[model samples]
Target: MERENAPVGPGDVVALVDGSFFMHRTYHLAASGDPARNLRPSDGFPNGAIRKFCERLLGFLEAGFGGTRPSHLGIFFDHSRRSHRSELFPGYKANRPEPPADLEALKPLFRDAVRAFGYGCIEAENYEADDLIATYATAASARGAHVLMVGSDKDLLQLVGPTVFAFDFEYGVPGRSGYRPARLFDAAAVAAAWEGTPPERLGDVLALMGDQTDNVPGVPGIGMKTAAKLVAEYGDLETLLANADAIKQPGRRDALLAHAETARLSRRLVELERNAPMPVPLDDLLLGWPDPDVLFPFVNAMEFSWLGRKLGQLYQVEASSYPSDPRFAAPVAGSGAAGLQALRYDAVLPAEGAPPFASDTAHCAVSAMPLSMAHIDGWLRFDFRSPDLRAEPGQGHEGWKIHVSVDPGRVAAAWDAILPIVAEARLQAKVAGPALAGRLGDSSHRQAGKMLVLYAETAPDVGRWRAVLTRVEEALDKAGVTPGPRVAGDR
Candidate 1:
């Protein structure tokens, strides 16, 4: 990965993010009280998905495959609710409920956020993230670049091959204590996951096995295993359907014969379109250094203090010293070394140490380093020990964690109220008291006994901590989650 502001060359790595898959997935997790989904700005915009996506983008850039970084990256999204598949079959994805309003509201910001970080945001009016990714991957791979598709959609594996791979990006691995590298799938790996159906023939397999999620109508009685076996024996969907009578299994043969045309339609639905119009030139996506002038205010406004600090270190500027309001400031033309020097000075805190955040009750100034940030952990112990529960300390009073319990059943309902504090204050949390059982989507109805533990870092004392807790209380109050009696160690 040669990322020195040069053109994307042969042998360079290209990473394409399936932005739509991640946003919807994050929304579902956040709606269930997942700590990572709580990012809300002062303006109350839904930014959790965007924030997490950006974090993963940073992680991907930092942790390239096998010590090789991606020299080019693109964030691809679906254009709208409908696509060519929907046009081909009105019943495509018809089973899904209407998308949540918050999720829809966050769509416009996806492009803005991606551009702010200097990555390409690609889309086509009637194509999905998968299709656009396929198009880009094809083009980039043709240019001799290895393509890394960052997404979990099985449909993407169709593009996995010698020059292409697919994987999902997650901030925290479920039930894991530390970072877990995602399993990258090449042609062989895709085949293994699909029961010996190779990547190229996956469409043929899917053609026989209808996808209920997408409402693609294949041969009614065929399943993944049977479909894979049939495709392997016949070598393709067309051949398999043409010779349905030869399948000794009467039920399978009859079903295939009855649904031959439907199977072809299903194959079309599952096929990736490799020629969707490019929204931007491939050369434009070549990795470039992020401009601090635009990057600093954007993260600060989103109240992503920890990320701001991390990026500040990379760019050598105090991101917090920039305005708290978000703005994509255009770079000053030819603002050479002298101009950057002045901006860096402006980003520097006063010689007296650190400046107090102007928010009401935001009085403490703490070091953003990991060692000092660990002081907040001494506040208490939790019932569970998952990586998502850990607090990410920030530089000011707002960068802290406060642990509190809410009835586990109320966690989901109270998320709306609780989100702002989590984002604005950059807090972290956990679930304690009792284990939640059953599906979390029905969490509001479940009579769980566990308590939700919300935590943060950077609170220097009990007073500052209480000030933050007061806001949480007000939010929780709105959601009808009254504070229980204080725990023994509570200050």
Candidate 2:
């Protein structure tokens, strides 16, 4: 496939997607309904992941970054599941079970779908999608083109710098009608997410606090906050380990001394390989107008009427012209925000005793303060004019959270009492932290009282949290729950 237009030059946005990450996530969490029901009409092939992947990519391309469409795009998949990380540490990602057989069978179709859109479908042997994304991002950055790394993987955050950013596309939770809003993270967002440990030093934090998902042996007992704190204090992992003997905390000192080599290995495992050999030069990835000749046929075969409408909008034509497979039933709604009936908004806030959020303009600019993530406290979640759209057991959603510690003493009363308050406040004021906790897990109730600590995402809008709190307080006056003293510096 050839691009019909000129390739992107300097200052164009190059969007690189982590294909394997998206495919598996879509197959498991984003694609609605059963895989059996979403098979391609031409053949009995499962095309749920393929359809959702294309839908999201199209949505992203339409949405663009800061009102600019991506000049180039690459969907890079893992050449194989195993990567150099596994070779460096045998136990790497051993904790993960095998990808579903049905999902694995659909990889080739995903690649074909990418090609149909006239975008680069790339993969290199023994390299993970992260490495490829890192490499392309680095190359794109060096060329003076901005890089947008798509996917929810934290490992990719290390690539966020002056001209590079990461975007986590929002998707509907499994078994839910509402969708999570997409989030864009820049250097400040990365620092906010990683407890003020700069994006470049996130590897040090990850090294100290091993990733259970990847089975990296970060020093045991070291969590994200502790690791971030240590890295912030010591500058890096090596410095922290070298000065372990002078550490005041006995347990931490002992863990660093005991797992010095293990921590080093974890760092290596978590670090991205930015120098992978690309099968095609960066110019080859530049996107042109989507060929209706190729795209229409694929969507037609799959009976993607909703996708057809989106494509029609993209091509500036009547959506009715596109044909769908008569046998397959079309989705009840169209694609993107307008098609979805409900929106689930969730965000992190700055908790009490934390410094104000700071925005970073070098990467991307947003108004917000950095809330402290010093500890995990019990969370308070409520609905916003929608049915409970929680995920099924063991399913994963975006990890973005709005941290507020509900009073344990008032847990019973506050649980049901805050529903209407949250819903109304969110609707009237348009605060961005109104969503159900998709899956509940273990949380601490240590400061379970009138105190409400709002922990924001790395860099979050301070006014959003403040507005929500003001509305919640006004509503609370008429309800059972009592508002605690507001945090200092809170408007």
Candidate 3:
């Protein structure tokens, strides 16, 4: 969520997943035929279901989650068969068969997998993930965050609007074997899919057609084409029912007139309850770096070596491998990127006029060191003059995004250290005037002096330097990487 006055910028990204749909899709599609036949873990449990889900989920993650690289990611599961829709109509989804044993068995593992990736999971007793996904998507859209509903379920199509898109990760590009490309569906795509009827009328279209899968009884003998035409002409089911007698064809008009209530019931069944209460804060769902501990072991056990390889590259810390490296042995030889070995580096603030201890000084000057953290005490110090700026492809030259680390325990301490430096930068920027200062949201400020200045947590507050400590704290908890104990909490 955002502040009441937040302006809708390019907006942050969020992905809402439909867990129930994934379970069945992955279980059946991972293998050639048998549901139980696929890669099994060391424990001999069938993992095809989970494996397929992982592969598809990774595509979303790898693609920066439909190119938004969502800061908050969520997967929602339906724990119960009953839902508000089913309660309203007992025959809702009555024709659907029981889920496959293998698919049903993978729910717990799926939940664990989602968590292992530093993402949140949601569940409700009498609400389907579909409804919850729609709720979150709608809320995110209204709040000005771009939402990607990561599922192929048709029910989600209606939710596609400004700030809310349906990214069907399982969509096949056709004739491209082993190449299921993720397709981004906007309002235009939704309208096109239903043949000229916009997403707003999806419920009405479905109501008249009557979802045979869900056993929703529409007016008898009204086919999909007929229903779509009626919805397009009438705007909605209620309008269509009210003006049924106007239809040129008496047969279809009579059917609509006779079963007006049935059409009404069907529309209610497909309509998404976008206001359903969410179980967790929407902000907490942003995807962060997955925990290496949980991710690596889980992938290995699932026999997803491909994913393991990617994680290994992305998460590798060479410091563990380069003990007594020659680069460290001689400062003269360690200045270049060729022999650069990542070591667990820590630099405490030295006393004024004190010499920098006899060790590597000029080595590896050019780098993009994530402000992973800083503090009030001299425990850590960063020099703004020698920032290691690196170009991130497609991210443009937003140097402010240079900081990536989140240390929960010492947010206060970090701010304390940054306050004076940031304050001086602000003052200098003001003295230089807006013409000299770089942009700060809608205004301009002297940014050169404030190289160390950071962004605020919300959009309205962006470009303004303030503590986003809560977001940082939540990020730590999500990554399972807690910061060390602080002096205040130590006692």
How many steric overlaps are in each model, in order?
A: 9, 13, 10
Q: Over the full model, what C-alpha lDDT does candidate 3 score relative to the true structure?
A: 0.57
Please, what are the lDDT tens digits per residue for candidate 2 over residues 143-177?
Answer: 78888998889999998998999997666665688
Q: Per-residue alpha-carbon lDDT of model 1 for 65-177, expressed as tens digits?
A: 55557888888877766788998999999888877645644555555667567667777767888999999899988988889998888899988889999876544667889
Return the candidate ranking by TM-score, descending: 1, 2, 3
Comparing 1 with 2 on TM-score, the higher-scoring candidate is: 1
- What are the models' TM-scores? 0.63, 0.61, 0.59
Lowest summed lDDT across 10 adjacent residues in model 3 is found at 426-435
What RMSD does each model have against the real structure? 18.6, 22.7, 19.2
Segments in model 3 whose C-alpha atoms lie over 4 Å from true places: 1-10, 33-37, 41-43, 65-68, 170-173, 176-182, 300-303, 317-491
Clashes of 2: 13
Q: Candidate 3 on 335-378: residue-level lDDT in tens?
A: 22243223112233234444433222333221221221242111
Best by TM-score: 1
* lDDT for predicted candidate 2 compared with the true structure: 0.63
* lDDT at residue 81 of model 1 (Cα atoms): 64
